[model samples]
Target: MSVENVRPVQSNCLLEVCVDSVAGLECAIEGGADRIELCSSLELGGLTPSAGFMQTAAHISPVPVYALNRPRSGDFVYSVLELDLIERDIEQARAAGLDGVVIGVSLPDLRLDIGALTRLKTAAKGLDCTLHRAFDLVPDFDVALEQAITLGFSRILSSGGALSAEQGLAMLRHLCKRSSGRISIMPGGGVGALNVPQFMALDGIKEVHGSCSSPSEAVHAKVTALGFASESSKHTDASKVRALKAALLVPSSD
Candidate 1:
């Protein structure tokens, strides 16, 4: 299996579950997630979790937790004020004793904003960093991969520029091989227990990310009517998390 820029698996695949609420956080741990990506709104593709949420997770989670450092919704093209907020949030995650921060910033032309990322990375020094899905938005993954590695990102959560990991398997596999083991290329987006086994054997994969979420049992009719919540809401499901963990043990063709 020797290949250019590729390495052997150093360890078993780790399950990283992304969560928005305290309940989701609890469920992720309870379901055996090796790590947690703390954020505010899954519906918005994950925003920075509040200081309070980080604090709560610090108190509640036994496993390592990383805060998503996105300041707002829309694009990854952040403004100066938003960058300020993101830096503050990175400090907050460290203050809350969280393990790391997930971050990404993009240019108008959809390239990784190197200057902005360098600043954020400086602020997040001494903590782990995961480059978020904004990597998928880049025009060239090979270029972005080099930039991300140089910026000191410990891992990257991406769906290979596609809507789902299954649909982007070829690119994802290439990224894994290309990354070797210099930086972890974690496949995510529409990932779940049912299909996790498929990703277990990539050349440089060491971790995988998923929401492990399901429809909220009681979507409170009144809450939706008042526009406080969407009628079709989802929450982290402990069973899904456990299933994903179990799935990771299976061998894969890939």
Candidate 2:
């Protein structure tokens, strides 16, 4: 394949898998995920993982792992102390050899908090930075896109303010086009193997994010004996990952 063709084929659909626990991390890596976003308390919409968890995830994950640095989950609005905690987490993640940091901050009015973001970026000096799905909550997607680039974010995880990626594909494509290579517009939320082909069919999308989940039937087991395995753990399945990858190849065939 020509380099340009191969380049897009290889990276046109980056799979970002979110892992709630160590088992989820292993599943994402085994499932052919290109990268991972590690966090705890998905029930609270994902808070920063503990130091021990961060260390273990970085060591075990085969693909690059990015730590979610949110101190709490209620909203993207953050306190100064929470920002400080996030900065410290970023430092720890980098030292632990994690690849990046996933963070978000916004004004009470739901606009990107430019000043807070600038500080967070500065703290993550040596690591890649991704503005998390909180981007979708910003009042103005267009304005947020511009600020993300200007603030030097490497990528953004969003769902176009919708509940799922499919619903947001139109806006996702628009953001990707407007980004103009200045930043990467990554469509996340409610992504799965079933929609990979549809997402690939849309123009300008280069990456996708999701937590492909199946119920953990073995939920009655305790972690002490099973060693961190949850009775209801959600992990990326390798078959699903391969299916999604294959689906992305269809456009090139056409």
Candidate 3:
């Protein structure tokens, strides 16, 4: 569906939960997520999920599912072949019936890759597109914000160049004000029940993105059985998602 045609979320302040597995998807949905960002290997900083996974999540999720289209873990600057791969991923997401795709591209100078993004946007066609956290790596936030708006991204997911949304509150507010409804500035990274109230106070934050993740003992055991030194397996926690949603509804102290 076109970005404009996407259904309004159930709550005024939408909660977007990022999940890597079917189990995580189930948890996010039960936890009252308004939307889901389907991906794989969150430890690698999120890679494009398999088509089967995307189809399964889209089929099972009640809310809109937006697939992450990153080809690799390292950086936002991609080679031509890598861009082609991303284009194919976007096509796969569309064919899988996902509501949107999250993506971003950058130049060596840390500027937005307008040409590459334009082609990716074309490949996305009718689906809603979000410029992902790659926005944080850009050298100039103001310039990048205008480029994202001109490129027609439905929203930009960022932590305002800080390590976490709470740490970047000031820049988040600045970007939100500068956006002026032309595009959405979604505060993500380290957002959870405890700090969501701070974001709610920001005037133009219509949506928030987070993993709301916690360590999973089951998965950790499996990894250990395979002889890998598993630090800990993380998955979206249903209770955390519910808590965040509840916190978003409470009036901010502002």
Top candidate (lDDT) = 3
lDDT for position 240 in model 3: 96
Give the TM-scores of the predictions, in the order they appear: 0.93, 0.86, 0.92
What would the per-residue lDDT of candidate 1 be over residues 1-254, giving only the tens digit for each residue? 11112212222688899999988887887778888899998999999899999999888776789999888899999989999999999999999999999999999999999999999999999999999989999999999999999998999899989999988888999998888888998999888877776777667777899999989877668988999998778999989987888777655558
* Lowest summed lDDT window (length 10), candidate 2: 1-10
Every model's Cα RMSD, please? Answer: 7.1, 5.4, 4.5
Per-model C-alpha lDDT, please?
Answer: 0.87, 0.79, 0.89
Of the two candidates 1 and 3, the one with more favorable lDDT, higher being better, is 3
State the TM-score for model 1: 0.93
Instruction: Judging by TM-score, tell me the better candidate of 1 and 2.
Output: 1
Off by over 4 Å in 2: 1-12, 221-236, 250-254
- lDDT winner between candidates 1 and 2: 1
Judge candidate 3 against the unseen true structure and give its global Cα lDDT, from 0 to 1.
0.89
Q: What is the lDDT of residue 205 in candidate 1?
A: 78
Question: Compared with the true structure, what per-residue lDDT tens digits does model 2 show for residues 197-232?
Answer: 767676666778877666655644566266666445
Clashes of 3: 0
